[model samples]
Target: MAIIAGSTITASQYIACSEKRDKYGHITSRISGASAKAGHMMRDNVFQTPTHTKEYDAVIIGGGVAGLAAARMLHHRGMNNYRLLELESHTGGNASFGSNKYSAFPLGAHYLPIPNTDNQPLLDMLAEAGILTGYNSNGLPVYNETDLCYDPEERLYIHDRWQEGLIPQLGTTKTTQQELKRWLDEMQQLRAIRGTDGRYAFDIPIANSSVDPAFRELDNINMRTYLQQKGYQSEELYWYLDYCCRDDYGAGIDIISAWAGIHYFASRKGKAANADNSQMLTWPQGNGRLVQHLQQFSKEKTLQQTIVYKVTPQGNRVAIDYYDMRLHTTQRIIAKACILATPQFVTQRLIPGGTYDHDFVYSPWLVANITLDRVPESSGYQLCWDNVIYRGKSLGYVYAQQQQLTQVQPERQVVTYYLPLDHLDPVSSRKYAIALEPQQWVKLITDDLEKVHPGIHEVIRDVDITVWGHGMIRPHTGFITGAARAAAQSSPYKNIFYAHSDLSGVSIFEEAFYHGNKAANALADYCS
Candidate 1:
């Protein structure tokens, strides 16, 4: 089919074998094989007599941000004897990144918004990592200017021209403009609202949010329903909300909960000494830079490419059995306490007879990093850090080297594109995404970009596709305030705990960090 403009050539014809190289690729076949390996181990009751057994004060399963945070907390408490096992060769999980000869680019997560000033723990971590150099005399965070996103932060292609911001301005009706203003006013009021119990209506870390039924009731309905009830009928407004939801939650307003959708706007109340709340700290490798800071806590004792298939709680200790992909052998670890930093799906498999509620739905996603000879030419405004196409199928692309300070720019640049596969259900989306090849992904991405940058295929140097089968947890109706989440956070065994962004029903960096610290503190107290 003819996907590009002004040309009768098919998408396949545009992408030749010599023009594309699939580097830093992650196919879902490996995930399927890993699942099969775990299933077989459970079905056959094969423990595979461990090659060696080691004991630790605590053992963490999954070396993602949550696991890394847990490790850091344990280290802070002076508990040195711990181990972290990760299924992937790298430890960043969804925040992973890859590098080419020209520049480094994000594979999944990319930016972190400026955090609320009240979040002391997060601020302290950032301070330790040197992102937050120190506090000013007014007690506000003084972030490193270099790490903050540079000018020309965001732009949107609308009405055949690029605008200075992502919001719909050109071609928008007067009614749409009024509705947008009303929506912004409502969100600002919501940001200042406090529950009777003295907590913000919507707060980061999610656990700190007010629990009043007034605000919590929003979780019972989808964001689309809430918007309709509020008398918002602007097509442009709906599209913007849908884009925001998909960018953060991997779902649209129709699928995500009203509370989650609102949180995306109201929860960010960060006050900074230099940068504004809307400003974000980013790097060429995206959040992978933050991951590197967290990885230091577990680097010495982490076992990458090791999958923990089973976790059995004995009378006093937990027995963990894992397969080391590199060594090609099974091993056992006995720990006084354990933290399962894995997602609910993997957690269910690790602990036999443990079944998660059906509300826990994960969305599949596709992320591609395309390298080009130079930035693609666009009309209206110049290329920004974030370039969005209004009413496009994807979340647009981010200029990977936007944070660079060098006077002379590199001839080659990489732009990372994100697409949440929300058209079908999660199961169907995963099946569809895994079946696609690199060339298919390249076509899908280039076709989307062709709307703004005509003949964009000519400057392309390479395309890398990473498919996340269970990308992020979807905050569907009632899932955020449901009993399932509360139950999942608590452990039946004294020495076992849980930590992951999935527990929060909205996957983000701050929530993952919060849960990790929460689980680590609980485990440390029990061990003490």
Candidate 2:
């Protein structure tokens, strides 16, 4: 359909999502064509204030993972004179969840890696969630067996059969196998190498990575250039590495930074007495459970459906102007300190001389949840938590309820399919994504799945599609160690602070949580 006239969508086609739900969670009959219009309005909204005003010690805008973390930290410090404002009716930003009678599934992010030994905030969150029981005599943490992924952790569809893991070496030449092994061994060696500063060359949250000029210079070039310079020409290896780039950065390897590319492999140092770095921690509802835990503060104090459009320094306080969509009133808040915990794109638009204008590039993504009456049997392995195709453009689906522990399998199942729009520029990709009709998406999704599961098309009952215009930031060449990234960590104003995953040059649960905690500590010192 074309862009509906007059921003607000009262049209029948867009409103049919409510009609499609069957006594369970609401289903998306279409790919939210209304979001494009709504998003434009949000960006283009003008700022003004009515007669209403409120006072608080701090005010947090944008209730995503970062905002929630800041709020939770502030509450833990006994700072209750604060409020959180969210643009959506619900919280959790990308870490949202949905449910039906059969199961609950993730809407965006699905899992978290085992925390590195240096990442204290992440480990604390996991321990509070009951996933981390205690430490062993070796000083390594012990994980709850239930939270760790069960047997048959992963499988890949290739060579007309399912393999035990995602690596595709079932039918390659001996030369290709040797090359792949060489790459794996190199990664292992790099993982253990430390810098002159006694720090691992690359570690979680990216900030703790070694600052040695030898390694830091890797950010000056793209991953493709780095790979080609190393005399690595294995097509299979490139395909696998390219898949990793698309899965994490939502961009092609040619455009992603070499430092970010290698960091994807070396930064993960998660270890446990019971689980290895390769093991993951996940739930049926994904990171939404973590979002809920962070939001365990005063609900009555929060202001949902609120848009913050302006932030200006007012003497020793920061003046925040926002409009509440639910109340249809514009209000003002004079906060002693402020945390703009929003995406880079949104934050840049909210204030003057905004950071990240020249260095940040956010990616666009597509996620479709497929609800099936019965999962059709495939030719290879029965089923695994994560299923990937050897050379496919889209990352294969994840079994949504794979963590459910029922002795007997349920009659129905759900799988979430992910696709990154990297074939074009971000602006063009978002336009093309929103213009696609529901039937067009259905055809595309079915065609992608039919490669492995022959009859999956017939078993699919419902398909809900969610499109993210600015999904996550891409760490392009010269970004990770550049001046723009370093300068973005602090705000121009003394009383106003900034926090978001984009500031870290990469988007992930660990980085966002760490960024929020760091910002909270900085702002807390000044709040008193």
Candidate 3:
């Protein structure tokens, strides 16, 4: 059917969505589209405030995981005369959640593998948050039983059998299995090997490592080329590697730099007593629980909403100009030091003419949470914590309520599925997302779920599609080299500082926290 742009959509073109379609030929999503457009206008209208208005010791722009972490740390340091400006009403950025009749669930990030034992600060934070109990006989930390993933933790529906791991098994050839084993063994070696400069080849706080160019050169090539050079060619292994890269980094193997790709596997040095290093601590409400704990240290009086327009430095202080959506006024905040924790893309807008030599590549993602009274049972194994269709386009579904492991009212389950829009560039991916209708999105999600569990459509009560247009930046080749870091640090005006995970070229919780902390310290040092 031919649909005209800017014209009232007819009954046939309405594209029915949940409770959006009516007998009167009206589609609620269409109205929602209009509402969303109006919301954007309202948000932009705040920028029209002509005059500057207020002052402070520091102005922190953005309120994502990184921004909030820095805010908490700065607050703890007794810096109360500062303002945290967020475009969104609430904080937590990608770690945000959505609530419905069923329960509150994550829209983006969903889990955190037990962190490295050496990361004492993170361990201390987790303990404070009540996620950690105590150390075992071996000195390994033990997580709260309530937060651990329940039995039937994972399964991959490949070759028509239920496998314990997410890897594709059953109907597999010997060559495929050998290649997979070989790859894993290689990763294990990398995990253990230390650099000549006396640092683990893979460690967090990326700067703490030895300055060895030999291993650093690995960032100059793509993962596909690196694997090819190693003579490890197996279609199944390639697909699995690609899937991992897409799931976490949002980019495919060919696009991600070889160093970053291998680092993904080798960097997770999490050790726990009751759980494996690879195990995750997740909950029904996703990472919202962690965000709540992080917010405990935020300065209550210094947070403002939908403000921050332009920033300029005047000798000793930085002038921050922003618009308040609720008050419909423009205000200014002057601070001794400022931290910008927004994504690189948004950071580009705030800085009028700042240019960095390093290229920042981001991948878009779609996170769907399907609420079901009952998920269709598989033939071989029961419902597991994480389920994936072998070699499928979709990243599969994670049972959000699995951690709690209790029969709650409404008998709800949230299947969080991730799909990376692996487009050539950000512009193309965002355009593709904008083009899809709400019904099309639902169909896109439901069709993929049905592939693994047939007849799942009937059991699902609700479908919430949260599209992260630019989810996480790809750690492509050369992005992590010291040169890239240097390029990112070069400020447009001596006053602005970059503090986004995108600048690090890798999007992990550790990197995000470290990035913010680095920015906070740099700001402090610069002003002092």
Q: Using lDDT, give the best candidate's number.
A: 1
Candidate 2, which segments miss by more than 4 Å at Cα? 1-28, 32-38, 353-356
| Global lDDT of model 2 | 0.80
* Superposition TM-score, candidate 2 onto the true structure: 0.92
Order the candidates by lDDT, highest first — what do you get? 1, 2, 3
Model 2 backbone overlap count: 0
Shift in Å, residue 284, candidate 3? 1.3
What TM-score fits each model? 0.93, 0.92, 0.89
Give the Å error, residue 225, model 2: 1.8
Model 2 C-alpha lDDT per residue in residues 1-528, reported as the tens digit of each score: 422111222346444633643322332355631245545656887646555998999988888888888887887778889889888777777787777778888778888888888787888877887889999999898998878887777888888888888877778889888889988887888888888888889887777888988888989999889889888888888888888898889987899988899998888878899998789888888887788787776465678878787787888998888888878888999999988898777787777666446578888888888888766777777788888887776888888888888877777898888888777788877887777777656656776788888867667877878888888889999988888778777788898788899888988988888877877877788986
Q: Comparing 2 and 3 by TM-score, which wins?
A: 2
